[model samples]
Target: DQQVKQNSPSLSVQEGRISILNCDYTNSMFDYFLWYKKYPAEGPTFLISISSIKDKNEDGRFTVFLNKSAKHLSLHIVPSQPGDSAVYFCAANLQGGSEKLVFGKGTKLTVNP
Candidate 1:
């Protein structure tokens, strides 16, 4: 069973609009959640993260929300820009275990100008 899943394979948004990506997980042991953005021919870069203790975390135009009870999470990007187009991966890991990250397949976001 895939512990982490991004049901939507892709999403499209107009420039200066909002982009939302969804993720789900079956593992309840995950205490930390993260969103990473990946570009073509490059590795994924950390975008934002949230601890299980909090429901939301934000940084500039990027925000991440976790619904622990539902085993779901989402990443919201306000005023999406062209450069924001990329594959986004939702990752989760135990707070103090082996520090390994489990990632979803990824959601490709296209920010059209």
Candidate 2:
């Protein structure tokens, strides 16, 4: 079973608009949440992350929000640009010791300029 899930397979947004990617998890033990962006042939690169203790974290135009009670998290990109288009994967893991990470199917985001 997948501990993490991204309900939407893809999302499209106009340039300068906002793109939101959603994720949900069935495991309550997850203490860390991470979002990664992958290009066509390159590896997934770390984008933004949020700790279970915090409700939100932001890096430049990217922001990650975690809702523990709902076991859900989301990544928000404001002023979404063409360069921001990629496959976004949401991942979760135990912060302290577990090297294991659970990842979602990934959401393909298309930014139209």
After superposing candidate 1 on the true structure, give the runs of residues whose Cα lies further than 4 Å from its correct spot: 97-99
Candidate no. 2 TM-score? 0.96
- Worst ten in a row by lDDT for model 2: 94-103
TM-scores for every predicted model: 0.96, 0.96
Whole-model lDDT per candidate: 0.94, 0.94
Backbone clashes in model 2:
0
Show pairs that collide, candidate 2: none
Scored against the true structure, residue 53 in model 1 reaches a CA lDDT of 97
* Whole-model lDDT, model 1: 0.94
For model 1, residues 1-113, the per-residue Cα lDDT tens digits are 89999999999999999999999999999989889999999999989989999999989999898999999999999989999999999999986763588999999999999
Q: What tens digits encode model 2's per-residue C-alpha lDDT throughout 5-112?
A: 999999999999999999999999999989999999999999988889999999999989899999999999998999999999999997575478889999999999
